[model samples]
Target: MSTIQQNIELAIERWRSESVSQHTLSDSSAYFRLAESLPLTDLDAATTLAEIFQHELTFIPTSRNSGDWFIWNGIIHAKDEKNLVDDYLATEFANALKKTADYATKYLADSTMSDEDKAAGRKGMADLYKYARSIRSAGGLNSLKTRIRYEFQQAPDFFDHDQRWAVMSDGRVIDLENVDEEPLAPCPERPVSRHLGVSQSGQWPAPASLPTRWAQALSDWTPDKEVQDYLRIAAGAALLGHGDAKNIVTLVGLSHTGKSTYINVLREVFGTYAGELPPTAIVQKYGGATNFEQHKARGKRFLYLSEPQKQRTDDAFLKALSGGGDTITTSKKGQDGVEWQAQCVLHIAANHIPEFDTSDDAIVGRMNIVGFDHVFSPESMQRNKNLVQELIEHEGSGIMFWILDGAREYLKLGHIPVPTSIRKRSQENVVESSAALMWLKEMVDSGELVIDPDAYMKDMITPKDGYAMFSRWCFDNGEQLPTQKKWLKDIEAFNHMPAERKGKRSDGHARVWGVRQSAHRESRKLHLVQDGGSTDFRDLLTQLETVPTVQ
Candidate 1:
């Protein structure tokens, strides 16, 4: 037979011998006896056999240390001879006796074997390899347990040492030294604060009744033709739902030009009986809550931020203000080394347009700019003041409050459709002041207001003519003017000329024609006077307004 076949036969014979002798010998003895019987002749054969048999040898080093065991193949060896010999004596004798009995039975069977029986014998030899593998595995388990015990004895304080035995009644044996005996304290739960709706005490009182002074003021007031026209358009736009009418109205102009006063009058007319305050105060009172819940609780339909500084406009602040419904969170360190988050709403207002440094355009688009003119006469200012005082006195009495309240209610229904024209205008002006004018023009075109076409044309056209004339004059007079400022200065100089030759310029030697600049300057300074030099141009504009002929 070949060397491999011979080794297979030997391994089978050893397995059968060990299996029968297992009952007679101690577990450790059986392992040692099998190792001794393993075939080891050629170097390769010896190594393979040693590896297969190593698992059966139980090692108990002289130092009683787990690390001292030298593992060969699957078996463990120790430097101590006493442990090796003891295990061998206990297991080898019985295994030898069993092997002797198996050999006797096989010898007898081989004598009576035929050609068919010879084939069966060869198959049995192959099955013996499996039996040898099983024996090796059983032996390895016993060796591992013995090594673990030796390791524990060597280092009683070993971090991973356990003295649990499977033979105990409960199958558990605890080492008293390994127990942790400290008490653990329980933790208390923290209380959390819940937010309640707006407090009754925090709300401003509603007016009991409309006062009488408001009516007298509105009736007695006679606004300048220009001022009246602007107010009428503003009111009509609001009534007709043009642009962001009920949303936010931004009055932008020079500081002393009555922007604040204009806002005040609007507040008196719409907020007096409604118990609404300006946007800044409202934001402050609610701790800057920008959500729908807080706004609804505070009974706010409109938010107003007056004269916000340029520095205050930031991305976070603008996002909150521009109906983005975003909150701003600021982290602050607490006394206990913890951080906190504070949130607030996004409403804002400013005296000047926000600086261009901000990267967020959402905030800018949501705001609308109303340019206030500084050309109001002294008489117009008096009339506006009287109208405002009267509205204040009649506070809760006027129908205007009801009208504003109705508008708010309508908006709350959430189905207010934006007309296509209005939407287009809003889109154009969302980033420009030109949107406000477009909104005004659309409102007039739609017949939302009772504007006298003649009066509006008269106001818009006459000023445009004077502006054009002054522009031409600057070009003719060798003036280095390319901007409005230079042209305005020249107009002012011409206006101060003597009345006798208002349209003439004296250049020391002789009088020169000054029709254009002089006409513009004179009309502006004197007021109510038309620049007659442009009568033909004025007629053309009038004809265009009156007749709808194709140009």
Candidate 2:
């Protein structure tokens, strides 16, 4: 016999032999499994698998039970290891479970599917499992996960992103995908993606009451009004399902400044919606050279990098995340790299801010730095031993409202406005934060201006020419080379005038540069200076070096 035929016959024999116990195997499961065993075309293999097997089996119908269930019996001359053949009688009850699951998933995913169809799908899943039909599924995504996991033994990795479907703070599923019915089962592996917290359930917690104790404790402990405002913005962005305004929000301070505590509060507030808080940054793996965790942040909405000691950030990865770049390459375990848009935001809180020396515009644009200088007394913290738990459990709906309201205001504000202190702190954090800005600031301080972008220009050089000179300047200074794009963007960032002006220079009627170097004594000093006025810059760097390093 042919290999395909042999395979089909063998599968049938195994089925018949196993069902000697009188198993009423459903046609779908039998057909699906037996037909799948063929190595060749399903057409011929299925015919042999089904027809030959059915012809060999015997059915003895019972008069007592409903016709919905069939009491079919079969026997097989199966042998044991000792080659002792016997007439084996076997039995199992198989129904249209696979068909029911297929129907249920199809209806659940079909946005335009009718309510009746949807209800049938729900009923199928509910009948199969208790959680689907329970009240616990009404709030968040955890129950949804539980049901899917229970049915399929694996996690889901896709959902419908087109419809902007989300589990709201109240836990009622809202899908741009779903119209009439409430939100239903979310599979985060096909169209888009989804995730739920470990401790969260599908049921929205009891009417989201306020966490007055937590709030009061926080206010009493860290009395910085700016910190309070920032907390609101951070929480709001997380709840509203939007990226942070600053793209990357960093909370920098000594330990006990509530960095971890605040993050825990956010976790409590967001519950199942909160994402994994990684101890190290993705780029910081392998001593900040390789990205071993590119897949870690793919489906997460809120990514927390807590106490990341290393300064190395994956510029391309972070840029894509910060809205600085459009796309990022992601890698799954043993999979090829795939590109995805930045639908997620990041929060990197550390005792010491990270530094970057890269020249990518996408990298430089992701600088939202906040410093918490206050160090709460250890004695005060000791008294509130269970404060974190109390806030998470008791704060109820009050924290929800606070965060949602903050989200509303955040939408109106366009982007989170960087406080001056944060901006300065950002400058201190990175070695190559903005070389152009640093140079400009240095020149201003030294009263030795070289190329004042703010000044109107008679020298209008081409962008290409300007990059050549800038490249040389950066190379000689042993600094990160400025790309043409970053050079232009830096000028724009500082609001310099005559950004791309056309003007005549010493070579009469000849275009030079938009922001030209002045024809003066100080301008000549730029050519003479070797260290770019290192004396003053050294002092500046010294002050910035106050942040201690920890391994």
The candidate that wins on TM-score is: 2
- Residue-wise lDDT of candidate 2 within 38-114, one digit each (tens)? 31222332333334444332221112210011111121111122210101111010112233334435535654555
Query: How many Å off is the CA of 480 in candidate 1?
Result: 29
- What C-alpha root-mean-square deviation, in Å, does candidate 2 show against the real structure? 17.9
Find the 10 residues in a row with the least total lDDT in model 1: 187-196
The sequence of per-residue lDDT tens digits that candidate 1 reaches over residues 62-92 is 2323322222211112223223322332233
| Candidate 2 residue-wise lDDT at 406 | 59
